[model samples]
Target: MKGTGEEVVSLFYIGTAIMLFLAFGLLFIVVTYQRHFFRMKRKEAENMLKVSLESEKNERARIAADLHDGVSGDLSAIKNYLSVLAKKESENKEIFDEIREGVDAALQNTRAVSHNLMPPLLETEGLVPALKGYLESIGAKAQIYFEVTANGAVALPASVAYQLFRVLQELTTNMVKYGNVSKCDINIALNKEALTIDITDDGTPFNFRENLAKPNASGLKNINSRLHAVGGVIVQEEEKQVGNHFTITLKNVNNA
Candidate 1:
């Protein structure tokens, strides 16, 4: 009887060991699966970011081409006409005045082209100052009241700054083209580890999600892509009666 009891006890110990082993194996599998899932998600995010950056580059190239082939060409022709007028001005006072006016207009056109391509304020001052200047310029054109506020000590990395600047440019352009907005508020803040940008407009409400899903929604896609490249995310708020709200959060720019 004692031998039989000892045999039963040994079997019980063996069964408990097997159960533990199975449990541990299942735990390992679960952990491994989670790890792989996260890895795949991260890879997908990286790919999306790469695509976004490429799109932005393409858009910039398009803008540059338009400026060079269209606006710049026109301005060059105007300048040439003015130069010819100046040469003929010695014979006619009216021609001299007309040539002077043409030169002034051409100069203004050149400055406008330069502003559109790359604002001088951005190159001379930092991002904040540049943004302020840009917003003011847009506001003037649209007869909109745009305000900007910045807080905190986080200075952005150049790459991140450029991306964010482009995002803002797109947003402002959309507002001017579609939103019919007469007022806008832009705010930037930085916490210890993150930078936050908020842009709100008093315009007709937009269905952002629907727009994002459309086939040719390049602007929103570009914004999302740029934000991703900068280790940032764009959060669109629920539509309120007032307007659209966009919040962009970027990580590690302060440290970078």
Candidate 2:
């Protein structure tokens, strides 16, 4: 009877150990499956964003083409005919000049919008030069100075380049309108594992966490979505008290 009791006790201990091991193994598998499911969802979302961005680019290109080729051509023809009319009538010079000036202004606005819709520089020259051209265009409106610096540059994919350009555009626009800064600085660097970009404005301190929660922060949200689509991230950089600083990081990118 004593031997039987001992055997029963040993069997109970073995059964308890096996149950605990099974519980732990099941928990691990569940955790791993959840993580994998979340990752797949995130990848799907990013792919959706990529498709949306491509569609947006195509639409922009079509509209820009219409404005530049269709509208601008008609405006030029009108301007030429107006010039001829002004030449014919010497007494109505003032009236014609006013009309001509109006037409010229309209033409200028059209060209600007067309260029903004899809800048030729961006397609032909790449991101940096395209940004330089954009800065020069905006220089007349805002009393801002532009500085672009780089360290051992590597060519970025066109999609990445466009997204980065949009990010810079939004930053500069916000700085000009709200931050009240005069000078802008952009730094670009590339290494074996990452592409790092810093954009600093000498205006106000920026808080990414704060703005990210605001409902009206469409610009920042746009920036975030763009970065995420390209496997990059935008975070507010600290260690600078003078102005607003932001950093963009792209990881596991092949830099050549």
Candidate 3:
């Protein structure tokens, strides 16, 4: 009887141990699944933020282009009419001269503002010509040597061109603002599948990934968002010998 009771007690202990082990295994699985779910949710939220910012930037660019093409053009025509009036009424010297000077100054100011809003060449000509003109303008302003090379001559969609142009502008602005060193290089190549752009500046080297996560630094974030909107990806790196570099690859949306 004593031996049977001892055997029964040992069996009960073994059963309790097995139940505890199973419970721990179940708890670990639940915790792991919950952690994975939260991680996925966080990534989704970040993507949503990127989409929202890109939409806002696109809207701003559209409005600026419209103002330049519509309002600025009208202002230019009015200035031209004033010029004709001035030419015909040369005898009314004082009034005509005053009108001419004021109108001319106003016209000049309008052109400058329009250029800032959206380069007229971007609308009149194609992307390549517009980019060439931009590079020339930047070169004239700064001491830095800027080089641009385009491999193929394919007409890109206007929206794609505009977004890419803005991206290039951002890169140039950053180079001027932060990259204190001298020279910069820009290269654009297009193939059947994709368009690739590389911008390198001999400036102070900084880790883009580190800077991107910092608070209130919206430039890199904005660039990433714009690239994402256009089905493009941007990679940033700092080389040991070279400076900061950005490589942007845009998928051919028309094909897709």
Candidate 4:
């Protein structure tokens, strides 16, 4: 009887051990599946964002080309015809001049819009020159001075360059239009391991986080999205007392 009872006790212990092992295995499987599912979803989201950005870029280029080649060409033709009409019809010379001025202004505005949409310098000379040209044009109009400094090798993939350019463009535009900026400085640092851009502006003080939290802040959201697409980050330096300072960093430059 004693031996039989001992065998029954041993069987109970063995059963409990098997049951615990099965439970743990089931839990591990569940956890692993969940992780894999989340990872796949995150990857899908990133791919979607990239696709959207690429589509927007292509659309901007198309619109810019249309404006430059189609509308600008038409306006130029009209202006030339008007010039001929002004000389032939001297009695209505003032009328012709007025029309010519309007046409010229329209032409200038169209060209400016086209340039902003897809800067020719960006395609021909690269990011730095494009930025300099953009800032120069803005400064001419707004009297805001910009100082750009580049350090290390600044070569980047075309896609990355476009993203960074757009991000900076938004930030600077916001500063000039809303932050009351006068003087701004941009620093670009790049190496094999990392890429960093520091932008400082003597503008009206504002809270980056608070503004970002606003429901209507689509521009800020776009900036965040662009940075995320390139595996980059933007940090607002709180220690700056006078104005706003922002730093963008991408650690895996090669991978990005």
Candidate No. with top TM-score: 4
Q: Which segments of candidate 4 are over 4 A away from where they belong?
A: 1-19, 252-255
> In model 2, where do residues sit more than 4 Å from their true spots?
89-92, 151-154, 191-193, 252-256
Selected candidate, larger TM-score, 1 vs 3: 1
Candidate maximizing lDDT:
4
lDDT of 4 by residue, 1-256 (tens): 9999999999999999999999999999999999999999999999999999989989999999999999999999999999999999999999999999999999999999999999988877777888889999987788899888888447777778888899999998898789888999999988767888999999888887888999999999999999999899999998465789999998886676
lDDT of 3 by residue, 122-169 (tens): 767867788878877776787778888888674787767767877787
Please, what are the lDDT tens digits per residue for candidate 2 over residues 46-105? 889989987887788789999999999999989999999999998999999999999999
RMSD of each: 5.4, 2.4, 4.5, 2.3
Deviation (Å) of 59 in candidate 4: 1.2
Clashing residue pairs in candidate 4 are: none
CA lDDT, every model vs. true structure: 0.80, 0.85, 0.76, 0.90
lDDT (0-100) at residue 38 of candidate 3? 93
Lowest-sum lDDT 10-residue window in model 2? 247-256
Sorted by TM-score (best first), the order is: 4, 2, 1, 3
Per-candidate TM vs. native? 0.69, 0.89, 0.68, 0.89
Higher-ranked by lDDT: 2 or 3: 2
